[model samples]
Structure formats: C-alpha cells, structure tokens
Target: MLTKNRAASFWNGVRMRTLAASPDPDEPPRMVTVPADWDQDAGAAFAAMAPGTGRASLADASMLWVGPLADHPQASHGLATRLLDLLLRRAAAPLPAVWHGLRGSAPGFVLNLAAFAQPEGGLEIDDFVQACETLAEAMHLLQPSGQTPCSLLLSNLDACLAALGLDYDSDPARAVAACLCALATTAMHPHSVPSRPGASAGSVPPASPVPGLTRFALARWQEAALRGRRSGRSPTHELLPETGPIETGLTAPGHALASWTDALLGVEACGAAPLFSPLRPDGRLAASTLARLAARGMSPEAALAASLAGNPVVAIAGPAATETMHRAITPFLDRAPEAPTEVQAPMRAAAGGGRRELPARRSGFTQKATVGGHAIYLRTGEYEDGRLGELSIAPARGSPVQRGLLEAVSQAVSLGLQHGVPLESYVETFAYARLGPGGAVEGDEAVGSATSTLDYVFRTLAHAYLGRSLPDQPQNAVPAEEPDDALLPLDLPRETHRPSGPRRRHGLRLVG
Candidate 1:
C-alpha cells in the first residue's frame, strides 16, 4: 500500500490522481488523489495545458521548461523561481543538463531570455538585450550561491536575424551574440572583479561562489520558426542559425560563436557542448540531405571525406562544476559503437557533410514481378518525406550462386542511394542492359518487355520513382528487320594456298 507520505515524496507535493494497488480482480479500481504542495499558479500551469494540446508532466527529470521571456517580461523572475523550485524538489541532485540535443544529455536547466522569431517589427535591439539582462538578474536572485547551474538559450535567433535583415554567418550577428554573452556573464558574476583586458589565461580571476548561469548557446529551429518569415516557408531553403544547416554541417561562424561564448564563461570546450552536434540518428548522413547534395551536382562521398579530414579531437573541461556532469555521462560513452576515437571538434573550423540518418521506424513497400519467366521481388524503404532511401532485390526461384549475386547487387544499390547516388543514374546505366531471360514482364503494368531481369527492374524503378518511362529497345523486344540496301560481302578473286612440300626441299630447289 502507498501511503500519503510516500506519495508526497514521489510527486514532490504535486497533485496526482492514480489507481490504488489492488490484488483482487473482482474489486473495482479505486482512485486516490494526492493534494499538491506548491502554490496555485504553478500548480494550475502544470495541470492545464494550452488549448489544442495535451497536458505535460513537470516531473520528468530530463525536461527543463524554458518559458518565453518575451511573452512575460515582468514574470521572468517569478517563473524562473517557480520552475527551479519545482525542479529541485523533483529532479535528482546535481541536475542533468544537455547542451547538444544530438549526442549528449540535456542540461539541468535552460532559460529562454528572448523570443527572437518576431515577424512583426515590434522587437528592438535594446529590448532584446534588456530581456537577457533582466533574466540574468532574476537567475542570480534565485541562485545567489551559484550552486544551481543554468544555461541561457536564445531561441529562433536565426529567424530573428533574418527578420532584421542580417545574415546568420556574418559579423553583425556575432556582435549581437557577444553582447548577450557579456551581459549574462556580468550578471552571473556581479560581485566578482572583472578580468583585465588581455589577461593571461592563468591570470583570470577565480570564479565567484554565487550561483548563476553556467553558459549560453543558440537554440535549434523550432516548429514556430517558419512563422517569423514574412514570405512564409520555403521548400528548397531552410532558415539559418539552426544547430547545423543542411547544406553545410555546421557554419564556421556558429562554431566560432560557441567557442567564444565558452571562453567567456572561463571554461574549456567539449563535444558540441555550447552549440551544435554533427551527429545524426543513424550515425550516417541523412538520405534527404544526400539527395539534395546529389541535386546540386556535388558528390556526397567527397563532401564527407572533406569534412572528416583532420578533425580536432574534443575534451571535457576540468572545472569542479563539470565533474558531476562528467560522472553522469560516463555510462553513455560507449552507446554508439562507431563513435569516433575522439569527439569531433566542438568549436573549430567549419566542416561539411554531416551524417543524415533514417528514423528508427521507417515507411516503404514491397513489389513482386516476373521478367521472361524469372521471378523477381523488389522491396523499398523511404525517408520521412517519402524519398526512396533503401532498396532490396531477390529472386523467388534461383540457385544459391544466383541469389547471392542478386543480393550483393541490391546491397550495393541500397548503399548508393543512401550515399546520394541519384536513381536516374542507376536507371540510365541498367535500363536496356542485355543478358538472358529476354521477353515480356508480368505482375507490373509499367514495364511490358525487357532484355533481362536487370533491365526490367531498373526500367520499372525509373517509371515509378523518376517518372521517366523508357521504351524497350527494338533488338530486345524483337528481331530487327534486315535492310535491302545492306552491302554484300566481298571475296578474294583467287584463293591462295601454301605449298604442300616441305620448306627444306623448296629452299634447296630454289638455291640450285
């Protein structure tokens, strides 16, 4: 039986309606309600979700609710306090914070200082920096001892920059980022003496004992990112200032920004800590990104090779604050079997051709057909956007050798597709290939005739995926008709034969 005290400890005084333990199958389910200990405002915020959305739990240890400071500038302090209080009660000690959403655990806490995606011209530069300053002050009040760690994230910064007619990879935007980082760092260390200009790395003043923000970083593109665009979303181009761009893995300026900010925080750089991670879900490049690369006449393999060349290894900062974070992450070090010997450069020169991965669960179909009495089965898998990503080919009736050969071919094709080889290239190469099994195709209306099973397979793929309908070759479809104007073969007027006599006798007669 769960007691009220036990429930209080588990839920941190949050109200919960749950079923009581009952062994009796015949007994009715009894609902138990535990009253909340927190105030009504936080409780109501926790219980009632925004319309058109389901309720979410604050009890999750990994989650950090970063309320929009732009929406409620005055409430930043109160909101931060309430959230921190709730988290402290619920989350385990030395809270976990994830900086890189891709390859690392989340941060203990993340706070949004400004809503950068303002489409309307209402946002001002002063206002944006002011909001950050205000949030920093609020954070200091909540954690005056600097014991509790928090990170500041600027959401929709890219869209905000675009709205202001600023390029993401330019100097002006970086100036804005530097200004924000400086302000937050000052607020975080209000009592500590400022470090002198050009101070030696070892001569910088020791960090303050007061609790404040640990560092700052740019946030990834959100679902609401497209809203900030005056002309609306684009099919070809994606908004900039994201964690990483599709065209290039990580922008050079973005990486420099992360490194600069971490340096401002007086810490060493680690793997994608202050900004973006190059890794994708499947530990490979995304099929869609590869396809886009292929469309641009760029070779995906070449791009990958260039990006991975001479990458700087990563290391964790040795500060005492990072010790707990380090211990928390030790278990996940070996999670990825192919993780590099050293972490990819956290903040360094820009690299291209990042891994694009298929989702754990994918969508696709299987196809069956016959070419000249040969049974062939074709299966395909697609990415999230229904782009063909994987292919499998098999023969229903074939010897072990033949089956092995077909399997090898399918595997090769599938790798090519994933690596950004266009389907058109494959279709053009194999469409009219001639071999055995020349005749009609069955179980598919798209292809009527083929010279070989390979021909039928590629032709069908061309019609289905590329929308290119290829006509069967005349020689393969039927025997070619002879032309009346064809030239006749010529023969020698007289046939010449070697002498039947031995060479020695002929030589002697000639000499005599």
Candidate 2:
C-alpha cells in the first residue's frame, strides 16, 4: 500500500506535470503519450472510433481537458470507451496508480465538465454519450464474467462521474448498468449485505411499480426504435423492465405467480434490482433499506446520525428514519464522543464588501489631522456612525515594502471602525500602534539605511506576526518621517555622441 506521503508526492508530481504540459489557452488539449505497451489496442480502437468530424488533435487538447464532456461529446464518449477497455484489460493489477494518473491527467476533468454543462442533447456536444453507452456495455460484461473488484472499480467511476455533476442517473440504461455492477460487487462481498429476513426466502410481495418510468423507458425505446437502432440483432437488455412482466423464470405454482410477483416486487420495494432500484434513480440511499436495518440492530436515531456524518446519500432518503437511527445509536456513540471547544472567529473576513444599506450616511472626512514635511492623506470616521467604509493601501510607485505596512495599518483602522472595536483594542489585538512616529537610533544600523528602510520595516513586522523569516531582508528598520522617496524619479542615460551622417553617396563613385 502507498503511504500518505507517497500518495501526496505522486499527486503533487501529477499536478506539476499537468500544469507544465497544459495546452495553450487558444488551443485544445492533446493526448499525452502513455507507455508503448499500455493498452495499445484500446488506444487504436479509440482513434478508430473518433467522431465523423471534429476529432481530437495534439495542438488543441485543452478543449477536452477541463470542461464538460458534452462540449465535445463525441470525442468524450470515444475516450471514455478507450479508457474502460484499457482498465478492463488490466483489472488484475493494482489500479489506483493507473486510475490516479488517468484522472489527474488531461481530458478527464475537462471532458466531464463539458458533458455536465450540456446535459440535454449530450450527443450533440461530443461523442462522450456514446462512450457512456460503451461503459454501460463494459459494466454489464464485467459483473458476471469477471472478478468482484470490477464492481468496486465501477462504483469508483460512478462516484467520480457524480462528483463532476454528470447525469449518470439521467440515462435509464446507464443507471441500470451501474446498479447491476454494484449488485454484482455486493454479491461478491456477502459480509457487506445488510440483514433483511424473508428477503432471501422470497416471501415478500412485489412492490408497486414506480410511476413515470414506464412512460420514460417506452419513450426512450421508441426514440431508439426510430433511429433504425442497429439492425441484425436485438440489443442486450441490461435490467428487467419495471412495467412489464419479468421473463427471468422467477415464478412459482399455486399462488398464481405470487412468488415471482413477490420476488419482483421485493426487488422493486428494496430498490435492489438493477433497473428498478430507487437508489439508481437519484444515486441516494434507500429508505426501505434503512428501515430494515432499524428492524435489525440499528436504531432510527443511529441511522440518522450516521447519515449526517457525511453520508448524504442516506440523509436524502428518510430524515425521520435517519433521526431515529441516530437516537438508537446515540448510547454507543456516547461511549467515545468528540470533545467540545470554544468557537474562534474565522481568520479571514468574508470576501467582497458587506451588505449595502439604504440612504447611505456620511461622516466627516477628517476628524483629526496633522501635517509633516511630507504630507499623506488619511480618512477618519466615527465608529457609532451608521456607515461602513474600506481602506486599502499598496506600494506608492518607488516606495518600498514599508508602504505596504502603512496600508495594512490603514486597513486595521477601517476594520476596527466597522466592528466597533476601540482604539486600545486595536492596539492590543494587533500588538502594535496604528499610527506612531519613531526615529532610527545609531545602534540600530542593522535595520539598514534609509534607501531600504521600507524593506526593513516589513521584514521585522512580518517576522513578529508570522513567526517566520522574511525573504530579502532589509538593511534598515527606520521609518522615513518625510516620505521623500514616495515618487523616486527614474534616470535614463544620454548618448555621448550621434552616429556619423549616412555614408555620403560614395558607393557609386567607388564602383566606377
């Protein structure tokens, strides 16, 4: 297993490489080179399946790198298919490395974003819709034919797609394919199954058919039917249809197909069947499953509590059930609970400005002021006044980092006023006076000369605040009382002499 540090290093390397090789802003992203032996057949197949027109090229690969997959739907679909083929061929290997590389590499994030951005008519965006279809096909092929981890891998892929906000659940066929993959995976790991008595006995009644799906599925079938939908063979049905009678040979005698009906309904009710599972509908947890768990050892309160702990899928199904589950689990949770602590305010303030008020109030521009040899502007307002203001400062042309310090002080003042913090509070909180006058002493020459005084001030202050060494230490720490260097002029050297007049028309005479 890769350690945390190793994984972190690997990710960091991937990021750096990605940034370095990123396509130019005006160009699309190109597929980077993989090992010669790495899924050569799959890559060839992908290249062969490139869309009829608008194929991916090395010059403009970024177009596929970071946006929705649908933006270039055709290409996206082709790529996904190629990747799946490669993955399946290498399923026996430790895949996390390869998966990380593929995901962190170009085209993955870009294509996903593009696909999600254009959900409707995804085919028009890119060939990725076809790729998703291919993925479904691959998933179906893997479940019964391959090893157990295949389903887990499929789950990871589903999670990745969902995280990118793609409509994995939007396509009924694709959803069913994914659910079947998950079921097969779950079957492999019997320990993972939640206990539900009578479910295995097949005594349960078939749940009511979910509404709207029959119409939706029929409409999809019809649309495909109109497309001439590839003649010569009927497409493999990934999951049993919810509306019609199942042809899976699940019937029993005397009850008039009651057992079969119960089996079908049980799958429907538990939302466990590939096509009909409710979890497949929105990618959320099932309420019935939670209820079953509650009937077992789990309590409603405990279930809800578990759901709240980042299991949003569970939370989405039954809030009351989850709550009850949480309550039931509370006693166990209390045995080892987190310690409480005081809430400290956030380090950074909210971005943008505070809420704007109506009938804005104004305060005197200057409450108190004094001038020196080099005068600088300062604004003052009352704390109690019903107005909010901002102060910003930056280096003034030639002024050094010291200018940044002054600006920071100004910002602190404004923040104090807005929060109704007192002057003393500001001084104490910041550990420094807002505005003060001090001179450099002879023994303080280590602070550097006046030319670099600003640098010295910034370095010293930053070190005290950040508890770290500052880059490029200044030679002087003394603040210049008179801002004489506020606008230092540039000096451009003048040429000592001019070039001799053009060659004097002697070329023709010399040739003669």
Candidate 3:
C-alpha cells in the first residue's frame, strides 16, 4: 500500500506534467499525430470529477493503474502515461445509457458497451469522427487489392510472425495482432484533425445539441468511411509504416505489457462480452495490481484507447465495418454465465472460440417426461467413458422459443456432466425448479405433480443416473415400484411416446 501510494503520487504528477506541456495542434499534423492536449484535458477533468481528498485522491488511482502498467512491455507504446490520462478521466465520468444497465463489473462479468455506440469523455466529436474514417479505411474489404493502415499493419504483422516463426493463425498470436493495430492507430495521423470546436482541456462540453445519433451525423460518417475505404484500395503510404511487433525497443514495463498483451488478446479476446469470455481476458498477471486491472478494471474509454493506443478503440468502419467488429466483439465484452454451455454459439464463433475444450457428448439415452401436461423428450449424449456429454430436450409441441429454451437448458446440463460435474450437482440446481407449466405426471413414477417441467426432468435424471430416490409429493407420493400411469385415465396422451413429429414441428411460426 505504501509503495502504491508513493508510486501513485509520482506517476500522477508525471501525467499532469506531460499532458500539461503538450499544446493542442493548431492545425492538422504534417503526419498523423495524437492530439497533444487530449491527455491534459482528460486529466484535468478527472481531477474535477474523481477528485481525491487532499493531495492523494487523483494521483492515488493514477498510481494504482500506472505502477503495474509501467511494469508491462506495452508501456513503451506510449500507453501507461497516456492511458493513465484517459482511464482515470473516463472512469470519473458517468456510464452511458448503453452501459447504464450493466448487472455489475466485478470479476464475474466481462463488461460490454453494446446496444449503441458510446462516445466517452476526453474526446471531441470531430476527432472521433476522424477516427471512424481511419478505421473504416483500414477495415472495409470491398475489393481484393488495397493498402489501408490496417491492411498494411496486418501485412507487417504477418511478416513479423513469419520472421519470428510465429503463426498468425495461432491463438497465442491474436494478442500480437491486436497490439499491432494499437500501434498503428497511434502512428497513423488522422487524415485531418480540425482545430478545437468544443470545450478546452479539463472542461466538459455542453449537453449534446442533438440527443441521439442523428441521420445527418450517420450519413456524414458513412461518407467519411467510404472515402477512407477508397483510399486504402492499395495500401497508401501516407500513414507511417511500422516494421514489426514490439520486439526489442520496449522497456521492462513495455515487455511485461507485451507479454500481457499476448496473454490477453487472442481468439479468446472477444471476451469483451459474454459469449466470448476468457478466464482472464486482461491476462492473469502475477502482480496484484495488474491482476486488479485485468479482473476488476472496466472502462470503455480505456478499452477503446488501449485498443487504439494513440486514442481509444470503439468500433467503426464502412457500412459493415463498425457493426462487423462490434458484432464480433459485443458478445465478448460482457461476462458469460458460470454455466459454460449456456452461451450463444454464433457469438462464440464470431468472437473467436472458447479457450477451454467443450467436449461433445451424446447420452444415447432418450427419456420421456411430462411437465405442464406437455410431453418433453430428453435426449442425452454421453462420452465413451459413460459420462454425460450433451443433452437435447424437445417438447412434443410448443413455440420455437419454448423449444429453444429447453434445448438450451439440456445443453447446459450436458456440458456440466461432461466437464466432471456430478449428477447430484445438477439435481441440486434443477430439482423443483418453479417456472413455466407444472402439473400431474401420468408416467415416470418418480414424479407426481411437478412444479415445473425442469423439476420433473431433473428429478427423473437424478433417479435414473444418480441412484437417488425421488422426493415424495404430498398429494401423489407413491412407492417406486408402482406405475405412475395408473393414476391417469388410459385415454390421455402417454408420456412414454414422442408426439407425432410433423405436427410437433409445425406449430406457430411468428406469434410471440
């Protein structure tokens, strides 16, 4: 704690000085240059909003972040000092409507800022607009040939990976890919950075004149994106050329940062959201401070800035450019559920596949159970070793949404079983679940009137797999040896059979 305070005191002062000295560009840079005063403006605003008591407040958090950042390898990318300037400032700012409803941002959930594009503190709309142009130029792939700052950077990274004998396609190599992009965002000057049109360094702008993303703004942005894409048609040289990854020139922190970068980003980095969460997206560092940044630290501005390095990384591109990256990244930013199999598959593939192996299982066992007076078919897949591998539950007849939910639950259960979970664990979770339809069961003697379908299915599984006896329902408790069907008239649909397939699959098409 003492070292943290001292370091915080020192680095906070460093940021104030560095940003204090950098005057805003009066005109566009001869080449792409990060706005000099952005740090100063952001820093000053932070002091106003997240002001610490006495001499300790501002610098304390700054130091808290920088001390560990200074130990990473990417620090040389001009990050620690600038990022300290950005994150501290933005964290002090309010969360946007897009991010307003987050459940929480602790170690559990990966914070995602989707729903709409969010413009955070310390950046001008014009500057942000310019970034969109650059991003769109580099990302749009309308034609086969072109040189975008992004494409060139990718090409350079490709060369680096080849020279280093690293595989660009490898999971470990993704961090390297993302780092290269961050470097380029810094090195490439914005095509044009107009003089200030808003408040100065340290001041907040007036409430937006237009509340939401207006049609005019969207159209202008689209045009800019088109121009950017056209320019990158053949890899223009206007942007500065970077030769390789942070191979040698990095300082110690820069090295550590680089190491973390590799560890953090990858096919798994999509963890910016739920479907693509990594166990430790920010890189599980040995140090407590870095660990906090990785596990507890959540900032959209910082996320954008770190991704961009020179600025911040919010999504952008041509017509599809922004959304594609967003669609790719959205699922990753938010935290996924504790149940691994509960994720949306499309998102996982889009963000990049999960880090852990999701082994496939087919129980080879199909059982019929009744819930809510509706028949449900529970199919289980097991591993060759006889452990449950996967599950599927289809209602004899129901809406797609209903069937989808059942299928999702079964899959989640199957995943748990295959991953070394005991049937008892599942029983503890799902037994007596109280939602959806619940009623008397005509078959499956272990259950009587289930409170919910999940209740009946789970209890049945417990009896069939775990050798545990079913709990007695006061109204219809019967000995295990008795046939539950005896309680019902023989005319009712039997729970033992699947309803005819054609009609079961042909229910309502679109009614909600």
Candidate 4:
C-alpha cells in the first residue's frame, strides 16, 4: 500500500539508495535496485520508524532529522535511558549507521546533545568536554562515509547546565559551549591542523582524518541567525550575500581583542570548523526547546548565541536553517508538498508554555438540579489526567433571554477553564452572588441552597474540585404587622376655613 514516493523516503532515511526501478506496475513494487553491500537489516530498521508520525520514518521527509544522542555504554540513569529509548524507538534509525552509505547522506542530523548529562547533577567541565570528544570519535569511526553534517542539539539544555552547576542562560554555559566546540571540532576536523609530533599539554588532540569528511562549515541560515541577533531584527535571505564565509571569530594569540570579546567569540583562533545548530522544522522551537530553555529559566536568544559559538549542542531559531536544508533535499522530495516559509510556518506559544488540548473522546458528567426553583443543568469535562477542563450550565426552565444569557456566560467560563484559568477565581467571583434565582434548594445533595444559579454552580465546583464546602445563607425573618392607628399623627391637625361657596361641613380642610 506504500506509494513509490513514500517508499523512497523510507529507503532514503535508512540510507538505502534506489539505483533504479522497474516499469510502472499496478501494484507496489517488491524489489528495486540498491547497493550490493546494502544490509537487509538496515532497510528493516526503518520499517517502523516514527510510526506514530504517520510516516515510514522521521528521516523520510523531515527537514532536519532530530533526536537524542546516546553514549556507547548507554546512560546509567533510568530517566536518561528511558528518554533515549523512546526517542530512538520513534526515530527507528540507529545513530551513525543510519548516517552511513556512499550513495547519499541525510541533509542534516540533529543529535540531542543534552542527553549526555548525568541525571544526578555535578557534571564537571572536563568530563563534559571529554564526553563530546568521545561522541565525535565514535561517530567518526562508525560512519566512514562522512556526508552527513551532524549537529549536537542542546535540547533539554538546562538540565545539563544544572549538571554543570552553571546558572541557566549565564555566561558560564556559553563559555563551556565554546570550549567543547573547540575540542570536539578539532576531533571532527583534524586535517585542518598542521602535522606535529605531539599535542601540547592541555591541548585537545585531533582525531585521524577521514577522506571526504567535510570540516565544520556554517549553514547559510546560521549566518542569518547571527545577523538577526546582532541587529535586533529578523534576517532575510535578501540581506545575505550570495557568496561569502561568515567570520568564525577566530583570532590571533597576540591580537588586541578584549578578553570579553574572545570569550564571546566562543571559538579558538584555528582553521577549525565552525559549529552551528539547526532550527526546528519551519523555524519554530521544538517541544524540546521549551523544555531545554524556557522551562529551565533560559532565553531563546541565549540558546541561539551559544549554538553559534561552535557548540553544535543547541537547537536554535534561524531564518535560513530550514530553507537551506529544504534546498538541499528538494530534488528528492515529492512535488506535492510545499517547502515551508517563514510566514506560513505555524506560530507556537513561547516562554516554556503551550496550549494543552483535550482528548477527542473526553470524559464528563451532567448534573440536573434546580436553584431557587429555577431548573438548571450543570455539565463538566475533564482532562486525561482527571483535571477539570470544561464546564457548561443550561437552564431547564427560563425566558428565552435568560437562557441565551446563561449560555453565553457558560461559554465564557468554559473558555477560561480550557485556557488554564483556575477554578478558584470563578468561585471567588460568583459563588455567593445574590442575583435572581436567589434562595433555593438544589436537587444536588452537595449544595442545599444558593443565592443564585451561578452561586450554586461555583459552590458545586468548589466542593468538587477545590475540596471546600460553603455554608448556606441564614433563614429570612418575618415582619411584624402595624396597627391602623399608627398611620395617624401623634398630635391633632388644625382645621382651616374653606371658601364661602362651601357650606359648613364637618370635614376639616387643610390649608395650602
């Protein structure tokens, strides 16, 4: 049932090149031309890749293949291991191996670099730098065909920052990023350095060079990222030159650049590759971005800058990242899908927050009752976690105007609850309102009486969700009857003479 294009995408993700195909047939093709050395296991590996994504694999048509990077021995921590397992399971393709093959490589591979941190904090700078080195070495040795440009994504970055005992978004994390980049890039691109008998003390040695392995090159989008941040504006392709290498901030040993400038540059003055992190698909932050930065008390701008300074460990926002990758693989993609544009990209809430939608099949209950003899129906909806998410009130008996008003009020309250408004706020505002439909016994046992329907609704919610009870109002008192003589004044009224036309009358007339 797989379409030829979909199948091709799967094969591409698994690194199996399709050399040729048979003439069109009515049914899906069983076989196709591939490398003689192609491992059947590799092809099988992608059969269930990202199955939940409704595609053969994430690499199939994704702009950037992003996932967490795992250590060789695997993480000793359960949480780290479980997360890695989940990501790899969803991705289906194995690291390094999925990146292999002479036919072609992925447009880019984003490795979640933060996965290397220990769950229990206290990760030292040297240990982290060594971990980066180990990863670079392992990747280089595994994938002899170095066509794939791997990016170490700093997703879940704050956790790693915590492990390092560094404050989030502080200068310390940036400093560590630069140091790690210098050491790791040296390992990934050793040929850039001249031959020497031995590495100097405290200097990170380069790994043996691999043929066709490209030195770290800045993606076009990364330069735009730097420009955008520096100018405090969004960068456009038009503003970028057609041809030029971005200054990688490399400096001479005796240069007059200030110490702050050197630290800010984040790279050593060597002919080493510049590290840059790719943005998420369509230039939006990934779920991991929120977790790594915002939730951890870091800012997006800080993460982007750290990424630019030779730490391939951060997933950042950039105008060019997606466009550049799209350009690289467009030829292989099916023509039906349109390339993502900045304007067309979906916007998401930032600051480590996002809308949590309710499930399609929701759970709820309706309560029928009367408040102050005004019949009402109350309904409630809950989230998967059993939290209240929606509420609706309907009057069983009322004027058309009253019904409409109640409907509108219910909708407004429901919207607020769905948008994360607390139940307590509604309770405080409406629980004891003395409005029409005032004073009543409700069918519901929880609330025996209420000043108004809203009072009943909120009081019910308070009891159900807030675990608090409201006391009923005091009973109304009866008034005493007054004597008829009480209406008379205490003193007798003076009589006034009427006009001559009126005969003597016993009735007294009041003067004007």
In terms of lDDT, which candidate is strongest? 4
TM-score of each: 0.27, 0.19, 0.26, 0.26
User: lDDT tens digits, residues 113-205, model 4?
Assistant: 344444333333343334444444333333335444432221233334434444333444543433333433333332232112222322321
Q: State each model's C-alpha RMSD to the native.
A: 24.5, 25.8, 24.4, 25.3
For residues 1-512, what per-residue lDDT tens digits would candidate 3 score against the true structure?
00111121233433322222111223221111112222332333232223222232334543453455456543344444443443333211121110122122110001111111222221133433333233222222111122311221111222232222233333333333233222223223232111122213221111222233233343442343345566563212233223111101111111211211211111111121111111121223212122223333545445546645633221111111212222321121111112222254554565465333323211245456666567776655445565555555666444436755775676566545544567788788877777687788855787777777888887877776667777745444433454345555566654666566432432323233
lDDT of each: 0.39, 0.27, 0.35, 0.40
The TM-score, computed over Cα atoms with residue i paired to residue i, of candidate 2 is 0.19
For 25-125, candidate 2 gives per-residue lDDT tens digits of 23332333222232222232222222222333211232232222323323434544354332323221112212222332111100121122122222221
| lDDT: worst 10-residue window of model 1 | 243-252
Which whole-number lDDT from 0 to 100 does residue 505 have in model 1? 23
Query: Residue 342's C-alpha lDDT in candidate 3?
Result: 28
Candidate that beats the other on lDDT, 3 or 4, i.e. the better one: 4
lDDT for residue 473 in candidate 3, whole number 0-100: 58
